[model samples]
Target: MTSPQSVYRAVAREVNRASISAPATRSKTIVKNFRTIIESGGQSNTEHFDHDLANAVTFMKSQRMYKILLERYNPLHDMSAEEKVKATARRVGLDVPLRENSDEGQ
Candidate 1:
């Protein structure tokens, strides 16, 4: 039973965060669409609200995935291949087993 205001605030926060790296047009579009839904009273309709929420969730997921991929593949970082893999694994909630000869524990 989440309140509409709470949901709006939460989505707004995520939209702002995603917009930081998003292209200007794309960010504006997201904001515009969200505002349209809100202003149209879509939240009062369960189906409309669920559909728009799903779209927002999908957009956020893609934004996060893009950021993760960018970080993983960015050559500017000094991360080693194994370190990159370990980082990705950690992000996905899995642990990379330590090698016996690895110096990471030292």
Candidate 2:
């Protein structure tokens, strides 16, 4: 009993609703996976739809993956590589020469 235009409109509305809810669902899943990984000592019994969340976390943290994720997922993510080295050195009480002169004439 609906016109073609009305069917198209309905489909569009449903698509918009799904799009709105999709991100929230994905965010919830990510948080849940992180929680499971933490609670289970690096084990996850649940099957992840796209990727294995626990394994992905392990790979990212391990040398298998690059260090970019640390900046991607933290407040200090904005710190540059040089800044991170400096911060690490300071934290461990190691003296590091300034970047400008540390590698100069060597």
Candidate 3:
């Protein structure tokens, strides 16, 4: 035979306890979400850095190849006018016919 006032006090105590813990629970969840976002941002930055590095490496290699070709072949000095035209077209992936290929028509 608990008094009605005693029952009301018991329910009020439990409600107060829940209200006190709610913010702590919400704070923990927010902290966890923030940490996850920071971690994912770091990973995305790493991936972007890796992609940039690979592109830089590819560009460096292409520059090195162009330098080597300039040194080894000296196209302006070594190639004739027609050869230069054909070589330029071939480098640009054009299918314009050269003298040899055009000669097939004669």
Candidate 4:
């Protein structure tokens, strides 16, 4: 049985090898999250954390790692703005129309 740490390492190795977009993006995000978690409880300043993350993201954006990951990710595939709005509405149950079939507006 593999531990999560081992799994993460393996994933990271694959992420490093993958020039595809998605996995690289995911790896970067995971690394950022780890950084945040690491510094959250310490004397770490918010600005420092933000600045570091921003810098790291920028650097990551330029690497072969980033390009490979981005290709896998292919930023073009995310939900459209319209779809996102509709999804949010559906989640809150706003999707069901309140009007009755016999309403006067009909």
Whole-model Cα lDDT per candidate?
0.70, 0.48, 0.53, 0.54
Q: Per-residue lDDT tens digits of candidate 2, residues 1-106?
A: 3333343344343333334355545445544544454446323333441235434434434532244456455635678898888877888999778557756668
lDDT of 3 by residue, 1-106 (tens): 3333343344343333434356545445533543454345445566664455445445555666676688687856667897788778888999665347766788
Q: Which prediction has more favorable TM-score, 1 or 2? A: 1
What TM-score, over all chains together, does every model reach?
Answer: 0.44, 0.25, 0.29, 0.28
The number of clashing residue pairs in model 3 is: 0
What 10-residue stretch in candidate 1 is worst by lDDT? 18-27
Q: Highest lDDT among the candidates is held by which one?
A: 1
Off by over 4 Å in 2: 1-75, 99-106
lDDT of 1 by residue, 13-57 (tens): 778776647555454676666667666665377776766676776
The C-alpha local distance difference test score for the whole of candidate 2 amounts to: 0.48
Please give me the total number of clashing residue pairs in predicted model 4: 12
TM-score for candidate 3: 0.29
Model 4 worst lDDT window (10 residues): 1-10
- Name the top TM-score candidate: 1
Query: Please, what's the RMSD in Å of model 2?
Result: 16.2
Q: Tell me which of candidates 1 and 4 scores higher on TM-score.
A: 1
Ten contiguous residues minimizing lDDT sum, candidate 3: 2-11
Model 4, global lDDT:
0.54
